[model samples]
Target: MTDQPAAESTTTITLHLWLDVVCPWCYIAKRRVQAAIGLFERPHDVTLVTRSWELHPDLQPGTGGPVDHDARVPGESVAPGEQRVRIEEAAVDHEIRFEWARAVRANTFDAHRLCALALELGGPALQSAMVERCFAAHFTEGLALDDHDVLQRISAEAGLDERRVAAVLASDDYAANVRADEEAGRRLGATRVPFLVANRTASASDLQSVEDYLGVLREVVTESA
Candidate 1:
């Protein structure tokens, strides 16, 4: 028989990111990862899944003070203040604004639940919009994340159905999903937010630049081939 042509490649790389909505570094990491994906040759073949990991699950819903930059970060050696400064300086290149002065340390369970609902309702694209909106609501606008009204507005802005969002927020819908994501992160040896896993094999925790993230993505792609 005559030789047949090679079949087209259909490999898809799934990038799982476990992040907290209120964590500034998570926000930076998200932006950098997005930028890296954009620069990838086969961006369309990549799937980004945002997973929940609450930084302060025990803190009461409505009881958080101003951003405490001096607090110790779980995975990093530098103080949060210095980290924030470094992130802020780097974020300028990404056109991301960090309103550090206005940020608050709030419990993110409800927000994480909302993200889970987004994923359930509309898959990765919708979930990504919901995530970006939530991050901007907290980090840029300084909105109160613990407030249902604020979340409702943010959800509506993210293009999620208002009634569905209301139903999810009204009840404890998707709480289990949020918890499961955190459990998965813990099993993966994550002690902090922005724990990134590529194709369930390679992983990275300290991504300093867009190039760093791009390198990880390329490595995974090469290994898959």
Candidate 2:
């Protein structure tokens, strides 16, 4: 018999991402992660597990002001106009459209719950679609993240079951999952949004470039191999 080469074994890398829906930085970081994954050698072997992190968790749901140059979380101080400028500059090449004039700063708890529901019902792909929808609605389309009707429409757009989504919105379904995700992020020493971890070992924080994310993914892949 002719000798044959051994088959390559695939190793799975679990990537955990903690983000808030309203965070512009998180949106940018997410795009960077996706870009890095596309450049990875074994992209299919990598699994993304999205988690929840609330930048303004204590803010009342459905209560928010119009997003503007001066918009900021209560009790947190920042130089006026600096934030908008900085984020716009950072996101210039990432295809993000701010639409800040029409944006609202509503609490993202309900959106996080909807994401949890997506994760429960369909897994990471579906959950990512749900998150992307929420992000686009809030950031690009200028929709309120906490509005139930908008959420219903978003959920439907993401191909989730309408009845289940309605149930999730009417009641507190997946709230515990959302809380657990936040608690997990806190335990991981994450003090801010857009926290990412690969293989439960390597981690990166806000605003890292795509190359930085690619480096972290390479470390995970190499160590696993």
Candidate 3:
């Protein structure tokens, strides 16, 4: 369990998370964060919300060329063979799945747009489901994230209306929001995938350890508690 200073009984704690649906490490971190928060006695009060971010927003409908850019230009690595295996292993360690077949890194802007809609509708739970479905479709099933057929399946699975999602993807409903997220990330100094910020106070330099993350969180939450 985690610990923070006992509060004055009036202050409220909120945790805002920044993440992208296609980022594997961000997905892993989510689970670890969940586990750590579970250690708290009343974690329900430690609210969490996910903000949209894109790892490769410029990625075209069919992109991420091979293991090398040249190979990727010609065509993607087939289901990313060994790469897919490694991703699945990483996910299993965290009790998750990463289904993006390294070969296909489709444009995620539309997906992020839908996520913004989900955020406004149901908050974290709905978006989390959508992220999981996207990961499974991209990594395990090797489906297209931009394909209407595949996205419809994912939307339906995530409890969103397939037809509604199809329309959202086809148009630019949340395009501005997606661009805003990208701009905000840039402003926040995020230059790479898996970048994380805690309470806008502390961030790990490389791959972060939960202990260090918790330390930062505790430092911020307790000081204000």
TM-score of each: 0.90, 0.89, 0.77
Model 1 lDDT vs. the true structure? 0.82
Q: Order candidates by TM-score, high to low.
A: 1, 2, 3
What lDDT score is found at residue 23 in candidate 3? Answer: 61
The segments of candidate 3 whose C-alpha lies over 4 angstroms from its true place after superposition are: 1-4, 7-11, 63-92, 98-103, 202-206
Residue pairs clashing, model 3: 1-39, 65-72, 66-72, 99-138, 99-139, 99-140, 100-138, 100-139
lDDT of 2: 0.83
Minimum summed lDDT over a 10-residue window in model 2 is located at 1-10
Candidate 1 error regions (>4 Å): 1-10, 72-76, 79-81
lDDT string for model 3 (76-127, tens) is 2534345445445545756674433353666777777777777666777787
Tens digits of per-residue lDDT, candidate 1, 65-115, equal 887755554455775457677667757877778787888878889999999
All candidates' lDDT scores? 0.82, 0.83, 0.61
* Candidate maximizing TM-score: 1
